[model samples]
Target: MSDILVLYYSQGGAVRDMAQLIARGIDSVPDMRARLRTVPKVSANCEATEPEIPATGAPYVELKDLEECVGLALGSPTRFGNMAAPMKYFLDGTTSLWLKGALIGKPAAVFTSTGSQHGGNESTLLTMMLPLLHHGMLIVGLPYSEPALASTTSGGTPYGASHIGGASDDRPITEDERKLCIALGKRLAITAAKLVA
Candidate 1:
């Protein structure tokens, strides 16, 4: 089975849940599996360091995960309409992969969780695609055909999947949001499989 990397950074856990939902969608495609990974939190203090392994949730992502995966599903929480600092920090370190054209022709997708209706979910998703695009990834988005994209009262977008996690970050993934996440994953896997075939 080929693996699709589900890489994400989560502070309050909503993004992590979205990652899992996307992975489930990827795994639903035959012969496709999800490789869940996370990035370490960036320390505010320059001297502080994260452990080699995280205390819980997905393991830290390595550059190798990017080269080895058939596709990618990137997720993060919105920070002022942008991806969280840790995720951006991790992406910034992938120059070596970029130099080698390691991700060229691969299919990619993005997902995010935000604190409110206009909390930059779309902007964050669009910005997250920039790095992937620079790596030569083919962006896969949720088309209007997905009924949830039209009916969603909470979060869903053609740019990708998203969730509105309330002010306290306690809101559960709505039914539409869940469906969109899975659809994005499935769509990415299928696109990658076709590209590699």
Candidate 2:
């Protein structure tokens, strides 16, 4: 079976929940599976170190995961209209993969969770694409063809799947947002399958 790496960094659990929904969508396809992984948190002190394994949730990501996956679904919570620091820290360490073209030609997608409706979910998704584009991966986005994109009042975008987590990051993923996450996952998995076949 081929694997689609679902890599994310979620502060309030919203992005992580979205990642799981996307993984379910990917696994719905024959011969495709999801490899869920998370990044370690960045240290503000600049000298502190996180434990090798997290207390809970997915394990920290490794560069080998990127090299081995047939496709990618990158998700993170939004921070000032950008990706969270942990995800960025992890991506910044992928120069070795970039040098070897490890992700080139693979299908990839992005997702994000924002604290508010106007809190930059789309921009975070778009900005996240910039590095993947540089890595030569093909970006797969949720098309308008996905009905949820047009009907979603909570969170769904042509750029990617998203969720509005509220200011306290307590809101649950809406039905529309959930569907779009699944759709995006299926889309990425299907595209990866075609390429592999």
What's the C-alpha lDDT at position 94 in model 2?
97
Q: Model 1 segments beyond 4 Å from truth?
A: 45-48
lDDT (tens digit, per residue) of candidate 2 on 106-157: 9999999999999999899999999999999999999999988999999999
lDDT by residue for model 1 (1-197), tens: 99999999998999999999999999999889999999987776432268989888789999999999999999999999999888998898899999999999999999999999999999999999999999999999999999999999999999999999999999999999999999999999999889878
> Each model's TM-score, in the order given?
0.97, 0.97
Model 2 weakest lDDT span, ten residues long: 41-50
- Model 1 error, position 191 (Å): 0.5
Best by lDDT: 1
In Å, residue 11's CA in model 1 sits off its true spot by 0.7
